[model samples]
Target: MTKDHYWPKALSKFWMDNEGKVCRLSSEGDLVRGAPAKFGVVGNHHYIDLEGPWSHSIESSFQAADDRISFVVDALNSLEAKPSNEEMAYMKRFKAGSFDSKSKNDFAESIASLIVRSPGFRHKLTLEQKAFRNEFLPDLPFRDSNDLKVLELRNIQIKYPEMIASLRASGKIIVMFSDSREFIFGEGFLQDIDGPNPLLPCKCFVPLTPGMAIAFVRPSGPYFSMPEVVTIQLTPNEVNLCNEITQIYSRRYIYFRSEQPVISKEFTDNVYYFLDYSKHPWMDGLLAAAVNFEDN
Candidate 1:
């Protein structure tokens, strides 16, 4: 059989099997339930749920799977260049660490180091590692409210129900919120709402007053050295699109239509490409997706 024909089939089968198995492995924690040993007054009972632990385990599994997928993809793309002995050893270490059956922290530093050494995956992995570290060992010292900007909104109402409905129908809009910032949209927002809604399918718009928005800034600290602000902006169409894309693709790999430049030659050649590409496909995509906005 030809390489092209065989390879596609192989890839499809591999992806199918791995995706299912990974999903199942990640969900194993969820299958087990926890029951509390004590009961509460007024016919109320308390139980210590294992959901949190289960969720953590699932998240770890997903991260490991993602890392493995990236490595495989990179290897496939570089079929012409066989891996060196050292590289093969590193790959083995990575595979072992991914399923080490220990806490994510146990393998985080090593995996991060390995990922940084690749030119294709450094940026994405860096972002993922940062998020993981933040979740596990939040740099509380970096969380100062002084740098945050607070905004308020009032007298907000839904205006364009039709538009909202259309977006929801197309799996675009999840949830719409009116805030001090333009508006905010979150994934699966619409689906989570339980009630008889009167908003039109495509014409509904969530309205807001001046005090509805809030912007929080990440304070300067060792963990979060750079200052960043998160603004809640929601518009019917924008929310729909954002939610749709987020649902369809992992946030790390999704590219949005924004003013922010996806990539720059100076940024890519100097910083990004030199890092590991196996874990940072998004970075590669970013560089590839960049347009010469300067000309336009």
Candidate 2:
């Protein structure tokens, strides 16, 4: 009976309005407001019916990660400025150094966990697994849905730690401060371009608050390489691009703190894709691969 928040409530609180509710633009093009605790949650989403009474431990771990990372987020949100790029580069290193290692690690793992445990990621995984089964193991007995759920949930638990380690080894953290409060994010914070694997994301972009975001940059990533830790300012165009990505990647709803006037029509125009699995944004690659396999 452990209700797990796929979108961690602690992080969602960042987008809350003065009324203590966040505005949610649903995939069906409906705008609604609700408390973070009620939204973005699923009953027993992370529960693994394992022995030793540790089925609820994953929720606890997520909560712990959220608690630790909230301080880092609050500190970032406090940075309200429009520094020039040169000044940003000069001051960013110092800003990055101010945070302790535990906070950074917790933030990293929290982002990874969110991606891994998301409903969108789970759907994509199911499609890929089904494709594998249909093509290679056609005669294999179909597994029970509950069994698969347990297996996936358990896999998330196992891979969570590994993902944190991978992020530490393969990527450097960067925080971006936005001059405009126009920034927004969704349940699917990281775009499809972020990575094919949730456990090993590359070039991930996560909006921490309307005024700030955090990213992980790989040495081989498209962006210019930087130090292990850095802070930077986002150009207005870059902020727009991030918001666009958020719109497409979000399967459930897009959360925002921007005023009602700023909730553009483009945000709700493509309502069909998210609600329909056949047209799911995350499935385009999988669909293309299936076509290639069939042709081959």
Pairs that clash in candidate 2: none
After the best TM-score superposition of candidate 2, give how far the Cα of residue 224 lies from its true spot, in angstroms.
Answer: 13
Q: What's the lDDT of the predicted structure labeled candidate 1?
A: 0.21
Task: For candidate 2, write residues 1-296 as lDDT tens digits.
Answer: 77788777777787787888877777566888888667778888777665556544467766667776677687656543335353233333223323456766766677777777677667666666677778998998456776667666666666667666655553456566777546776665453323334344345567777778766644333332233455556667656666766675566577777443244444566431232322334223222221122100
Model 1, runs deviating above 4 Å = 1-227, 250-296
**For model 1, what is the alpha-carbon lDDT of residue 266?**
26
